[model samples]
Target: MNAIFLMLMGLGAMALGYFVYSKFICEKIFKVDPHFRTPAHEMQDGIDYVPTNKYILWGHHFTSVAGAAPIIGPAIAVIWGWVPAFLWVVFGTIFFAGVHDAGAIWASARNKAKSIGSLTGDIVGNRARSIFMIVIFLVLLMVNAVFAVVISGQLINFPSATLPVWGAIIVALIIGQLIYRKIIGLLLVTIIGVVALYAMIYAGPMIPLALPDSIAGFSARQSWIVILFAYAAIASLLPVWMLLQPRDYINGIQLFIGLILVYGAVLISGPEIVAPAFNNELPEGTPSMIPLLFVTIACGAISGFHGLVSSGTTSKQLDKEPDVRFVGYFGAVGEGSLALAAIIAATAGFASLADWQAIYHSFGQGGVSAFINGGANILQQGIGLDTVLAQTLLTVMVVLFAGTTMDTGLRLQRYIFQEWGHIYNVGWMQKAAPATFLAVGSCLLLAFGAGGDGAGGMLIWPLFGTTNQLLAGLTLLVITVMLVKKRRPMWYTLGPLIFLLVMTTLALLTQLKSFYDKGDWFLFTLDLVVLAAAILVSLECTATLTKQIKANKASPATDQP
Candidate 1:
């Protein structure tokens, strides 16, 4: 099969999702009121709650939700064959991710921009909220810690990407100043930022830099991890408009360009689908593809993390209530498109079946590294760009996205800490500096304390997919309850909620056994905690649903905003 078929099919599905399906949900289901005052306007704090243009807010939401998971997940899951991964990315985005993301933002905005975790208290119950918040924190912890290791590894591996990756930050700072300070027009600044970014990409191969192993007595990777966390702490502390918004907005544009390069290359070259549609010959220890495939491709299809981002940060910045359809749903579409690109690059970028097999000899093999190498090859062959420069371009794309996500995740984690502070009546934890310190401190502990290497974040990575999907199911449950209370059609969110919960529960059971047998008691215990939380939250949501249904039956439907 030609890669163009997958490209056309995926892109076409997402277009219909945006144009047709999203319209139905936005108008009929969400009933987005144009006149509705959003938290961004109601609060109007310059720090985190400034009203933003839909486009810029969309950029921030998309990039923060994206991270490297979309790339990493599909890149690895293609091991099950591109057919399964491709199907999941396309239909999952249309049916699952789009609604979940858009619904999350709508739910949060309607409720005064509360994080999904906090919203659970009012809609579900305080008990459920406590459990839900823990799950959210664990997810954020996994994200911040793992992404730091991911970026560190990429920087160490692709030294050429180092300059462009860090240079983009400086470019973003200037763009933020220019845009927010009204120093220049959005168009000219966008043009300038992107040009500067690409110029750095072009110059990256000319001056590749690598740190020595003994930097501050830590290995280069460890040192990079420390540096990245430091940067994230600072970025999280800064005002969203000062760095987060502009950085993500520009990087979102850069990713679109990067996607065009790869997709355009596919159209021009028509690469063969070298990998099998279904792999009958499994790697020795590959898990069954049933539940694993769903979790492995979580971000591209549906992610609980998206709900956190939607409610945590994006909802607070929405300029209009109706923008949820675009910023929330389209953001999922954007990540799904990136996942599709990863699928194409991974399965089709190789020269032959045997060569692809060499790369996929293991389940976890062929992730970010595979995507970069294969994507660079496609660019070089199809567009005649220098392979080195192409690699730098793709590398910088991954690094910038992951870096932005880390910034957002850490910030969200800080919010979680402050929320906890309020719950426990701890004054210092509510402070920005102290909460940020706790967030960074916990991630650092997970990194250095658990695994001891710079890769400690990988310690809990195996559980991220299951835990994340479980949280997504719980988030949808919250949204479903809101819809039920409103007397709106909720089959869209409820169906995916049920599906995700089932798959995630099954996956958790499988992992529980796997961990127990391997004697990895630490992860086994953590898995148990997550599994228990999933069960508890599900019960609370069910109870809340029943109560809402009974109340609706007893009285006339009272519509809510």
Candidate 2:
């Protein structure tokens, strides 16, 4: 259980998945045709649709999908045991998430870069499609609220990070302007931005920016959430090139530096994972680890949200069909790597067994803080940085990840609102400001209204995991239907589809039990809604598969799409 050994094993397994398992998927299942003219070219409009280089697309896709969930999930999952979490992250990323992500891109690219929400109609019929869209809308809404709280939580607890984080945003806006206006070359601007960001990280501790506890009785956490959403409302309305894209590029580089630093720290510090191989000390009310762990450690292993990202912006920008495996599949493995690092840092790098245990004791409220503390330990011990500075840097890193996801989630929600507006014949909802307000307002209400504990994101946070995994299950269902229609070898998708459907359903059921036991009516209602959606999806997917099976049996001439 050495940290270095776990790092090497986890990363090595992801590499094997990418090289070996993904190769099998590419050749046999997808049969990616380099010659296939991707929709990026066929449907080029220069606005929403354009062919992008694979690497740039990967950066967009990777940062969009690699958010706090990966960090939070495994950091908490290690409470069960490092070994179970490790196995799931390595294998699940390869087989479940990797396949789902790549398949989503492939499905959408073939059909003209339509989103998973839109594609559901074609693959699963109108009714199921509508339910699926509702699921996506709900997922995105929770994402915005939850991540707002996540970043705000970091700001509340780690005030030293505030300067560097807000500083990075200003730098990102400048980077956006410079890169867009051609005042400076892209390569040089990026380098300058990264350098400036690191400098802010170093200087942040000297002038920490802390929020006051209350403003006219509004608590600091609540106040930050409101401000963050207001910022998100504007950020979502702006063009992607102005702020989103530039900042994402910076985030991608920062992520690489983080991974390298943590791994190097593991080597230098030589910490061993002191947590048990199979932890049995979880709190009494905690659900059994089997299905819960799979859903809990979602993004690191397999997630449905990646499908939204793959289909959301990445599909529109993808340059070629063959590049899908690299951007979609490999982006997933990249997240798995981040999650693995989180697991390593959480279980081993906390400096003492008692400290790690203390973090887990209140993990529901403070798991992510534990992750930051563990990572900070590595930075201080391995790289000779001041402990305060180290913690500040790591906290800012997590905040950037959360911030990007929040901004992007708002944007995606806007698109969903506009899309649904058209469907429902609501003309005003199709416009930018109205759509943006609706998206932002919904998030604000959810963040502060129903779920408020005088906190930004605490209310909707619990439902995020189950909803996320169920969304993945729903997306896989869509993919399976798409493959069946194509008459392609569908075992690759169908197996994962079945697995996710069962796993998510079990988790949802378990959650419902917990909600009912606690008499939490609001959460109980929402979980019931999601459970109903799952049932609808399962029925629709089952029917589609049955029809396809019977059709093939009825006629040998009909082939896959």
Candidate 3:
């Protein structure tokens, strides 16, 4: 089969979902109240709460939620073949991810732009809010750890990526000063930034900046990890407009160009689909598709992390409540489109059937790396680019994705710490400097101390998928709670929520056997804690649902905002 067919099919489905199904959702379910004043206008702080153009906010939200996870997920998941991963990416985004993301934004916007953590109290109870907040902390911890490892790995292992990665940051800073200071139109800045980013990709190999084996006695990887966290610390501490929003705008442009490049390659090259529709032969320790596929492909298909970005940050920056549909739903479709690009590159962009199989065979070392190699092949074969430069281009893209995600994760973690301190009345913990240290310190410990020699960030990666999916399940449950509060029918959110809960729970349960067999008590214990947290959050969600149903039965429906 020609790869173009699958690419067009995926794009067609997304367009249909956006126009048809997403319209039904907007009209019947999350009715937008244009008359309502948004928090961005009400609380115009010009920092976190400033009103932003829908396009710009959409860029910010999409870039942050995307990162490397979507690429990493579907890139690895094609191990099951393109069929399952492709199907999930299509329907899953249309129904689950788009709804969850839009619902999160709507739910938070309706409640004075509160974080989803704060909105939990209104549905479950006040205490459940605290519980979910702690869950957010864990989510942030995993994010920071995983991305730090990913970026450093790119720096150390793929030295060609380093120049383009850091070069884009400098480019973003220039664009920031130009646009934010009103020196140039955003359209002109965007064009220049995108071109400059690609230029850097071409220029990257000319000045590869690989770290040495020892930096003040630390190993290269270890030294890179410390440097990454330091960069994340400063990025997180800075105001949104200063660095993050501007940088993400540049990334937002890169992502679309990437989609064009990868998909454009499909149209040009028309590579054959040699990988099976569903590979039944199981590799040792490879997860069954039953629950693992869903977890592995969270960001593109469905993710709880989107909820935090939507409610915690995006809601506070909305220019209008009506724009929620565009920013939230379209942002999700944008992510799914990116995932589709990855699926195409992995399944159809391979040099040969034997080459694809060889890459998947070394899954541990190159699951993520395959995307870089395959993407390079696509660029080389279709776009007439040099193979080495093409490889460097993708490596830099991945590093940039990971870098932005790391910055956003640390920022969210800092928010959780400050929120925890204020809600619990811990005076000293409310300060940004202390909270930044503590937040970065914990991630450091997880990435280094407990990770020991593996201190590269793999310590938490084994079950990070399960925990992240659990967070997605919880996010959907929270969306359900928000709907019920408004006397809205919630089958759309409820169905996906239940499905995610079951799959993630089952995935964790299945993984425990290996944890025990390996005598890895550390992971074994952590798994149990996450499992318990899922159970508790589910109970709270269930209780809220029951109470809502009973109240409606006993009296007339009391509609809420």
Candidate 4:
């Protein structure tokens, strides 16, 4: 099959999802009211809760939730076949991801922009919230630690991306100031920011930068990790408008441009997909595609992390209730598009089936590297651009996406701490500076202490997929509960909720055996803990939902908020 055919089909599905399905959800199901004042206005603080333009908020939400997972997951999952990955990305975005993301924001905004962790208590019970928060914290910790490592490694491998990657930060700071001060219109700001960023991209190869081979006894990767965390801590401290919002906004625009280049290249070059649509000859040690595929393509299809981002930061910035459909659902569509592009690049960029086979000989072998090389080739072949420049563009795009996610992850971690303070009455933890310190410190400890080489985050990464999906299931459960309480159509949220829970539970059980068989006691215990938490939270939610449903059936007028 030609890549353009797949691209058009995938893009068309997502477009229908955004315009048709999402509208039904927003109107008939969620009943989003444009007049509804969101938490951004109700608790308008200049720091975390500020009324933001839907476009800017969408950029922040999209880029923050995107990170590198959509790229990495689909790129790697093609080991199964591009067909499965593509179908899941397209349909999952329409049904699962869009609904969950938009629903999370709606639920959060209705409840004062509470993080999903905190809102569990109100909807389910205190015990559920406590357990859910543990999973949420673990997810955040893994995201922060792993993204730092990812950016660090990418920088080292693609030195030409360094100048543009870091230089874009300065551009963001300037753009932030302009946006916040109302000194310039968003259009002009976007034009200026993107132009300056591209100029830096053009100059990047000429002024590539790298850390010393050893910094204070740390290798270059380790040194880069430390520096990244330091930048995240400071970014977390700054107000959202000052750095986070504008940075994400610009990065989101830049990523869209990158996507257009890759997608357009596919349309023009019309590369034939050399890999089989469905591979009967499986790689050695390949897990069953059933549960693994769902967990593997978490972000591109449906992700628990997207819930964290939606409720954590995005909800707080939503200007009105109706914007959730745009900022949350459309943001998800954007990610699905990226994942589709990744599937195309990884499958079609190679010249022949043998070449594609060589790259997918094993799972995890092909990831962002595959996307970069394959995408660079497509860009060169289709547009006649320099291969080196194309690589630099894609590499910088990945780095920026990861960087924006880390920024939001760190800030969300701080919010977690503040929520803990409110719950436990620990006054000190409520302060932003102290909370940020703890957030950064915990990630650093995990990175350096768990693994001396600064790859410690990888130790917990195997659990990330299942754990992330588990959380997504839980998030959908929360949204379903909200829908039931309001007498809204619950099937939209409930259907995906049931599917995710079943799949995630199966994945968790499968991993439990894998971890125990390997005699990895630490991960085994942690997995056991997470599985137990999932069960506990599920039970709590089920119990609460049962009561809500029974009460509704018993008394039509009895509504519990």
Steric collisions counted per model? 0, 6, 1, 0
The CA lDDT at 26 in model 1 is 92
Per-candidate local distance difference test: 0.94, 0.82, 0.83, 0.92
Off by over 4 Å in 2: 45-47, 177-186, 215-217, 362-366, 451-456, 557-561
Superposed model 1: Cα runs more than 4 Å off: none
Cα lDDT of model 1 overall? 0.94
Comparison by lDDT, 3 against 4, better one: 4
lDDT of 2 by residue, 205-304 (tens): 8888887888878788888888888888888877666777777778878888878988898889888887788877776566789788888888888887
Q: Which pairs clash in the backbone of model 4? A: none
Q: Which RMSD values do the candidates have, in order?
A: 0.9, 2.1, 1.7, 1.2
What are the runs in model 4 whose C-alpha is more than 4 Å off? 558-561
Off by over 4 Å in 3: 362-366, 451-456
Residue 94 of model 4: what lDDT? Answer: 98
The TM-score values for the models, in the order shown, are 0.99, 0.95, 0.96, 0.98
Better of 2 and 4 by TM-score: 4
Please give the TM-score that candidate 3 achieves against the real structure: 0.96
Please write out the lDDT profile of model 3 over residues 260-354, one tens digit for every residue.
88888778988888777898765677867888888888889988888988988889888888888888889899999988888887877676888
Ranking by TM-score: 1, 4, 3, 2
